[model samples]
Target: MSEKIALGNWGEELVAKKARCPKCKNAKTLKKLTQNFKCADLICDFCGFVAQVKTSSTNDINTLPNSILGAAWGPQKERMDAGIYTSLFVVLRSKSDKNYSIFFLPSELQVPEMFVAREPLSGNAKRAGWQGFLIDTTLVADRFVRLI
Candidate 1:
């Protein structure tokens, strides 16, 4: 598998093992959903809480970045229009020590202003014309709940 995929899988595994569901308070109940589920990566089987996980290797695990690249813009926009927003789990791995710090951004704190649409993919690229987004962490930095 690609390094990106492996890193993502490792981050998800860390979350599944360490993070507890805010709703149900169960750590083991969080299941990794398929990649097809664009809106979320982990789901709580007990409370039905869904969260999108973003993993990044950073120099400082204690600090959250100003921006985080997000998934497809279309589905996120659709959900935003319908007033449905998934919670976010940001997993930051220390580049030097390889320790992880997980932060949770509740769905209630998410807003359209936090999602900035990215330019569409080039025609020559696979999945041409597909667009993504970036989560503007500056907008909700103070609201994140540290889970680990």
Candidate 2:
């Protein structure tokens, strides 16, 4: 039997199938677990093959021309206060090198900071107020997928 794991409120689920290991080619032995609710860390137990799962369910967001530049999350207390469990600050980079950092709720994209241009944020800048480059998440439309 396969294990059905709920990937939080992203409306995405991981159906752990008994498939061949990508490295060893062993049959029906792959298992996966996430380190966070964001499902950022998906690992296979057999040959230690790591795979990234797409979290977006919409084509619009998936088709966005923008790219992720940076990301951050509120403190636990702040997250609970906002009535959002897993929140993030997503920094988006356009093709023209224009960067904007937006406060990303688990359900939607909010609080965008506008600037003509943005750099990679120095350590001092980050300490002051910048979250720097998030550069990991690829599913843009997943921001709009919400659970209420």
Candidate 3:
């Protein structure tokens, strides 16, 4: 059997683990879990934060220089023992058993640095604080929040 093949560079760039988890300050433990990046330390769970999470990163989402095209959302669990905060609010979801889902911004818009949008009937609001979300703006205006 004979096969013919032809191609240049597949018009692709390798995602060479170009980033690190700001919470744990870890780079070697990054793992691509589906579309989101997960921490390799299954037990650590210090932060199951997204790896190449573009929307959350300061360089991508913050400095868009236009309407807020989009934003990343994730829930974090409390890890008080781990000496770090965790994700708990279901930001991108409804009152269901499923996990959070990603939402898109069709147009550019401005959102408050401390934006917290939630459902009207989501019971989670009572349990979790204002935004079960975290934004480490203590050091910088657009730093990532500690999530799990």
Say which candidate scores most in TM-score: 1
TM-score of 3: 0.26
Error of 2 at 42 (Å): 1.6
| List of clashing residue pairs for candidate 2 | 69-134, 70-133, 70-134, 71-134
lDDT of 2 by residue, 56-138 (tens): 22233324324442223333224435654223322222334333222233323323221112343476763665433333344
lDDT of 3 at 132: 36
lDDT of 1 by residue, 1-148 (tens): 9887788888888888888997889769998998768789999999888888899889999999999888899999999999999989999998899688999999999878999999999999899999999999999999998978
Q: Cα lDDT of all candidates, in order?
A: 0.90, 0.34, 0.27
True-structure RMSD, every candidate: 1.0, 15.4, 15.0
Which 10 successive residues of model 1 have the least lDDT summed?
Answer: 3-12
Ranking by lDDT: 1, 2, 3
Which residue runs of candidate 2 sit more than 4 Å off their true CA positions? 1-12, 18-20, 37-40, 60-148
| Alpha-carbon deviation at 139 in model 3, angstroms | 16
How high is the lDDT of residue 128 in model 1?
97
